[model samples]
Target: MKHTIAEVKISYHPNRLKGAVKITSSEYAGKVIRENWNQGTLNLYEEFKILLMNNSNEVLGLAPLSRGGMTGTLVDMRILFATVIKSGATSIITVHNHPSGKLKPSQADINIYNKIKDAAKLLDINYLDNLIITEDGKFSFMDEGY
Candidate 1:
C-alpha cells in the first residue's frame, strides 16, 4: 500500500541509521533520493535500489524493493541483486526508511547489510551503500564509518 505523511506519526531520534551512501555532486542522484523521500511518510519502511554507473557515478535506475509495515521492510536480496545485475550496474546502493525516525541501525539491520555485502561481493557487484532515510533527511553508514 502507498503511504503518505498524513497517515503516520513519525518520531525523530538520533542514531537511527547505521550505513551510508557516497555523496556525489550529481543533481540527478540527489533529486532521485529526495523525490523518493517525499513520496512517503517519515519512518515508513520501504526498500529502494539505486543503480549507478561504475565509471561516472551516473544514476541508472531507482526501484523499490518492497513496501513494508510502518516500522519494518522486508527486502529480498535475490530481487535486489537480480535487478542490479539485469541493469548491468557495476555498483548499487540500497536505501530503506525507518518509520520511527530513529537513524540507528538495529542488529537485524546490520546482519542484513552484511549479507547483502557478501552477496554483492560474490557477484562482483559493489554494494556501494545502505542508506537510512527519515523525514528530517538521510543517513549514511559508510559516511559514519559503520
Candidate 2:
C-alpha cells in the first residue's frame, strides 16, 4: 500500500536588509523588536516574532510567528525553521511579549530558546538572542549569558 501526505514548500521575495541597520547590542535588538510590537495590544496577549537578519547582522525582516492567550504562545518548530530557511536568514533574534509586564523569562521560555538555538545550529543558522518584552522594559537572554 502507498501513503499520501501533504507537502510543504518555502519561498520568499528577494528583499534584503535596508540601511544596513546592524544589531550592535542587545539593547539595539530590543528597541527594534519593541518597535514592531503593537503597544495597545501588547498587554492583551502574548505574541512571538523573529527578527530575521543577514550574515552581517543587518535587519532583513520581521516575521510574527504566533499569537496566544495572555500568558503564553505556542511555537511550532517546523514553522520557525521554515520561516528562517524561506527568508534565507543567516541569523535570527527571537522575541515574545509577556502580557503581565514581567521581564523575567519563565522556564518554558528558556526551554524554547534552547530548542530553537540547537535546531538553528544544525541548520547552520545562528540563534542570536531571545528577548522577553514588556511595556516597561525588556529582558535579553544573551545579556544574561544564556
Candidate 3:
C-alpha cells in the first residue's frame, strides 16, 4: 500500500488594503490596525494580528493570528513567518490588543518580539514595529527604539 502526504497550502486573495493606506508612521499603522479589531471582543480578549506590507509600505493584507483571554495571546513564530512568506510581504508590523488598557509590554512581550525580529532577519524580511494597544492608546516598540 502507498500513502501520500498532504502538501502545505497557502492562500491569499486580492483583498489588498486601500493603496492609500501607507504605514508611514507607527501612529498611522496603529490606527489602521485598530480599525481591523473585533470591537465586541477587543475589551474582552487579547488578539494578535499582522500588518503585512509590500516594498512600498503598501498594506498587502491583515492576517489575524490568535486570540486569548484578558491577559495575553499566543503567537506561533513558525506560523507567523509562513504567513509573511506566503503573503509575499517584504515587511510586517505586529499588533496586539491589551484588554487591561495598559500599554506597557511585559518581559514576555519583549522577549517574543526579539525572537520574531531575529527570525525575520534570518529570513531577510523586515520586522518593523510591534504595537501594544488599548482602545484609547498604544505603545510602539519602534517608537521607543526597541
TM-score of each: 0.72, 0.90, 0.91
lDDT of 1 by residue, 39-106 (tens): 54555555555544444455565677787777677878888876776666687777777777787888
**1-146: candidate 3 lDDT, tens digit per residue:** 88999998768665654545788999899888888777788789999999999888889888998988899889999899888998999989998999999998999899989999999999999888999989798999999989
- Top candidate (lDDT): 2
Scored against the true structure, residue 9 in model 3 reaches a CA lDDT of 73
lDDT string for model 2 (7-47, tens) is 97656786653477789898989898788789998999999
From the highest TM-score down, the ranking of the candidates is: 3, 2, 1
Error of 1 at 52 (Å): 4.0
Give the lDDT of residue 125 in candidate 2. Answer: 98
lDDT of 3 at 88: 90
Q: What's model 1's overall lDDT?
A: 0.67
CA-only RMSD, every prediction: 13.6, 2.5, 1.8
Q: Against the correct fold, how does model 1 do in TM-score?
A: 0.72
Considering lDDT, where higher is better, how would the candidates rank from best to worst? 2, 3, 1
Give per-residue lDDT, candidate 3, residue 91: 85
Better of 2 and 3 by lDDT: 2
Q: Pick out the ten consecutive residues of candidate 1 with the lowest summed lDDT.
A: 12-21
